[model samples]
Target: MQTCEVETIIQAAMPEADIDVSGEECNFTVAIISERFEGQNLMQRQKGVLALFEEPLKTGRLHALTIKAFTPAQYAEMQNTFLVQLES
Candidate 1:
């Protein structure tokens, strides 16, 4: 699946997220920022994302995926931000 479509599925689950996805079209490197991730541990946050793609992964529609997930507060601390690029 295209990263945009994958991102859309994730966004449906976590509407506040700002997501950037790139890779070999199927394999993906994803960066996500969302308030829903706040206070959640790394495993939980990753699980939330993985849950969204369970079927795709299981069905082999997606080959591999790497994810970087962050809470809005943590994302704000990033020296370079993704949301600003999206807004513009």
Candidate 2:
């Protein structure tokens, strides 16, 4: 349930993705950027990430997971918005 372990699992499933994970044991928030998500809808993207943690989730080893999935362009847009907010 460590962030690194969660990250590892996700990376194993999607090696090309760029992932950032935070939070403590049993609970995590993940932000993932990947081309694989380009044509997928929100739920589809979430499911694709969540599916990697099925065992941990089912066993309660991972209690809560919040996911933010995006394509590289989407992530860049989000980052730009964040920077603009910071400047304001």
Candidate 3:
């Protein structure tokens, strides 16, 4: 599936998420930030996103997806670090 299409599906699952999608047509990378991820461990957070595309994954319309999930606080920290790296 297309990157935007994949992004739309995941965003629908977590409306508050900040998402960036890139890569090949059927395989893509997704970075997601959402308040809904709060208090959830890595596995749980991953599962939450995976659940959103259970059907697409099963049908093979989507070949592969790499996901990075984080809560708002975590994402803020990460964003700051990224900005720091860019500035340096």
**Best-matching candidate per lDDT:** 2
Local accuracy of candidate 1 as per-residue lDDT tens digits, 31-88: 9988888889999988878989999999998988898998877877674567667678
**Candidate 2 structure quality by residue, lDDT tens digits, 38-73:** 899999999888888899999999999999999999
Clashes of each: 0, 0, 0
In order, candidate lDDTs are 0.85, 0.94, 0.86
Output the lDDT of residue 31, model 1: 95
Q: Model 3 — TM-score against the truth?
A: 0.85
Put the candidates in lDDT order, highest first.
2, 3, 1
Q: How accurate is candidate 1 locally (lDDT)?
A: 0.85
Judging by TM-score against the true structure, name the best candidate. Answer: 2
Tens digit of per-residue lDDT, candidate 3, span 8-39: 99878777778999987678889988888888
* Candidate 3 clashes between residue pairs 3 or more apart in a chain or in different chains: none
What's model 3's lDDT at 59?
92
Candidate 2 Cα misplacement greater than 4 A, ranges: none
Superior candidate under lDDT, 1 versus 3: 3
